[model samples]
Target: MALKATVLKARLNISDMDRGYYQEHAFSLAQHPSETPNRIMVRLLAFMLNASETLTFSKGLSDEGEPELAERDLTGDITLWVAFGQPDEKWLRKASAQAKAVRLYTYGGRTVPLWLAQNKAALARLPELEIWEFSEEDLDALTGWFERSMTFQCSITEGVLYLNNDDESLTITPIRIKDRS
Candidate 1:
């Protein structure tokens, strides 16, 4: 007879696991062996900016064999459960509520009332809007940068990321989900 087992793990601790995935990837991209502090910061920032988003999540049925990830409803805005690893339904419901609560402040508003933000499905459809007040010089620079870099296909320059101030350093690096399927 044959048997199967399931595997579970906690989410990587962001503060402690600095060298785990993102840093390793960035180091591999380097031509030399010495790991620069700036490279670590650059890759981390890039990873965060790219990965933040609203994800619809669903779980597989127990009788279906191994659990699986599936899409939830995207038609309506709702709160969603996002886990660092495979999650149980109770945890999902709790996490969905928490995530929605946190995002309310991100929209530049007062704290969302518990009653108003309780619907998980309704909160999921909220668009992630990032507003930046750009000056005329900043606007022109952004356009020029996008035209020369993002619009056309070009390899990114090495060691180009740098820190401008101490205040800009405290930022949350968004979670990146690796494709297993």
Candidate 2:
């Protein structure tokens, strides 16, 4: 028999000073059998970074044709595509063609720089793509805050993110290595 995906629920109170977006979202996400707590926490971090009323999680990991999370317009057009981890240049090219804006949150520390060095030239060709990388230390810190049921207070200002889980708060600063626009 096939193993089922585990369901995790999260409540996020987000305050984005840069975007002037503030809201609270309560949602559930399915964690695939092959996924780790690190990846799930990264996905949740991505959600808080780009939280929107219309943004919804897609069949990520399960579907290669869709983004991990996306914001669609009323016309059913994908406006923003969000993805986590290191993605192939070929797939990013496809995503750039499909969406008006594409953002990649790449983790895994030192490997990210090497991966970018290998594909930076080709990636620069896509003006819609933005690549942000998280340090392994910071990712590990964020992962420590993960749980099956959790609540977080997030605030973003300038280029830094502050995530508060009860009494403890973690600070994260994702470096932007590529931004054509």
Candidate 3:
């Protein structure tokens, strides 16, 4: 017997002033049994950060070969591969080889420094890889706003994200460890 994934419904209103992109997307995402609320929110944030018609949540945690999220072209060519948490270097290497761009969102507080010290040199060599880190406190605040049926108004400006659920708002600025440029 196995535990089933929980399906979460979300409607996101996005205004990316930096990119001059504005769109609203409504979708359902699955949360694995072992995944925490922080991870779920991270996934949603990743989708909001790279909102596109072709960007979609993949079989994350369940499918090892697939990215946590991906954006593909009409021809089914992968344009971007997005990963959350700290993945093995080999996994990132494979993702870098397969996708046009690879982005990793690393979280988990103090462990991040040690992890970066061990892997930064190897990761820096990957031209397509961009790494961002979410602070534990900020992530905790973001997770505090999570709900099963959620409708969020999200705005991004000057590389900062403002997410509001009407009752509360969270400001998040992910720190970039490595830029694709």
The TM-score values for the models, in the order shown, are 0.19, 0.95, 0.96
| lDDT of the structure predicted as candidate 1 | 0.25
How far residue 154's Cα lies from its native spot in candidate 3, in Å, is 0.5
**After superposition on all CA atoms, what RMSD does each candidate show versus the true structure?**
17.4, 1.2, 1.0
Per residue, candidate 3 scores C-alpha lDDT tens digits across 1-181 of: 9999999999999999988889999988898899999999888888889998889887547787898799998898789999989889999999999999999998999999999999978888899999999999999998888888999999999989999997998899999989995
**Runs in model 3 with CA error above 4 Å?**
none
Task: Estimate, for each residue in 1-181, the C-alpha lDDT of model 2 and write its tens digit.
Answer: 9888988999999999989999999998899999888889888888888999999997546887898899999998899999888888999999999999999999987788889889978998999999888889998998988889989999999978899998699999988888856
lDDT (0 to 1) per candidate: 0.25, 0.89, 0.90
lDDT of 1 at 75: 62
- As a whole number from 0 to 100, the lDDT of residue 8 in candidate 2 is 90
User: Which candidate tops lDDT?
Assistant: 3
**Ten residues in a row with the worst lDDT in model 2?**
58-67
- Top candidate by TM-score: 3
TM-score of 2: 0.95
Model 1: what TM-score? Answer: 0.19
